[model samples]
Target: MENATTLQLDPEANSNQTIDSQEKILTGDRATGSLHLGHFVGSLQQRVQLQYRYAQTILVADMQGLTDNGHNPQKISANILNVVADYLAVGIDPLKTTICLQSAIPALAELTMYYANLVSIARLERNPTVKNEIKSKSFGRSIPAGFLTYPISQAADITAFKATLVPVGEDQLPMLEQTNEIVRRLNHIAQQDILVECKPLLSKVSRLPSVDGKSKMSKSMGNTIMLSASEKEISKAIKAMYTDSSHLRVSDKGQVEGNVVFTYLDAFHQDQDYVANLKEQYTAGGLGDGSIKKILDECLQELLKPIRQSREKFIADPSQLIAILKEGTERSNDESNDVLAQVKKAFGLNLF
Candidate 1:
């Protein structure tokens, strides 16, 4: 109902839709953090819609979790169920979408180890995300080995599922490129199309900035509004949101150029005409950030109400939720194993 989501356009939206292409997709989040508005607007929102349309697979990346936060294993483990809860809390149906725990599959680790050799230390060093995160986290001298090798691990995550399309933000373009490089090398060496080249499924709105006006919204930064938040919680969070550098006085003409509230409205609010009207009002010197935030809050509450209720329903019966996840994991393994077998044979690993 909120615009035509990826699910709407995906051919796997229904059983009746053609299953012609092996466009099996693998995408997911690191259970290292909470699900935020940024996650929804950027990836999960599209994913929820896309799953119905494509042969979609949603992975709970606990293995990737350990790569960086291996010491915080329990923290990562606790978030697993919470992350899945958030997934189902959205529209990611377990029956239609394969939701697997990444740590549960040993084949992925094996594949990752193999792909690791194909990449160069220089290539990994050039990865923008790795560089940024390492500097930000101040891991200059103490970088973990897994942290350095995450790009290869990501390639395994994508190829193990034989995902033809990988939904990533622009920041992740390098990672997708890395995965395709492996695919090319493997396919060429084997004299067969053992791996499929993946494309970046960048959404028109690629990412949501943090509410505090940082480059990206992050859980650790404390600038997020969770999809499962109550109306009161959402309102409180919006009221406390940071705005532009100027606009100190009530009557001072405010700039909507980087206002978090307006940004959120533009990304999440579907009433385009209303958004346009609000933008005009704010720019023309009549609208207050408070006024805009009020409407934004209402729109967000309407969006979150159903989701919160759905989350509550799922929480009421934990066993049913586990069963759904187990079913999805089983289905995912069946398909991923086929891709793994092909990769192993191409590398002559099956000779053993």
Candidate 2:
């Protein structure tokens, strides 16, 4: 695998910046739908590793989900437990990682409202992430105000935890900028620094392509194989996965680049010798798409089988699952309360 570009942070620019020796990390998924393999390879696996090293907090971002799914609030509620199950299934330890719901934390909402006033409408419009999402969702004229200003809410999520490290993909780089911008502005206005600036922890295996070789693998695109997909579902998705269209016959040369099967293998398969030999054969000819897809299917099933079993165990005990989230929500609220109080004091709103 090739090395990815490194992310840089500006520590000297803000003399008020302070970092805890044990760096705290805050990351999460939107409860808009069940997570898929893209989530696994991209962030879930990395979160599991970061738990042992940092004070980790995972959020089921239902409030953020409501930004786009405002008309369908039921969808967000329905998937909350599913997202929790997926997190535990993928080895996110409850003891080591705090798993909380965004809406359950009142401080987050309060912080967002305060931070929203710090950022201007023109600056929000210039945010690359917001612009890109607006275009992607085709919300041209009717873009939701919440969706446009999600970056501010996101800043609250990070700072409320005092998180110093945030795991993000390349596309989300601008979000970190927006967050730090708010922090800087607040510190400058109040004549005291209240919020801590965060740095981006770029994922090694960034974005995964859709099974149909589309730009990204997303549930909305109908191109994803869910993390909890059954053997039959996995088989169906693999059969439909896109391959080199120019490779007419088994004997014809094929292009490995942009091929979804090989992409999956690169991300999931561990055997270097086997993958190298297969790639050679695939490029030279004789190997077929069916054979490649079969290998990918088997690899995915093997990877997900244990995750599926773990998810089922948690799902079977719904009360225990809810209890876990409630516990985390309580812990997270306690942590954020201090930050919110400080913000209020800075703005002279703590007079009461």
Which candidate should be chosen as best, given lDDT against the real structure?
A: 2
Residue 334 displacement in candidate 1 (angstroms): 2.1
- Residue 303, model 2: Cα distance from true site in angstroms: 0.4
Question: How far is each candidate from the true structure, as Cα RMSD in Å?
Answer: 3.9, 5.5
User: What is the model-wide C-alpha lDDT for candidate 1?
Assistant: 0.79
At residue 146, give the lDDT of candidate 2. Answer: 93
Where is model 2 more than 4 Å wrong at Cα? 1-20
Tens digit per residue, CA lDDT, model 2, 81-188: 999999999999899899999999999999999999988988998989899999998998699999988999999999999888888888888899989888888788
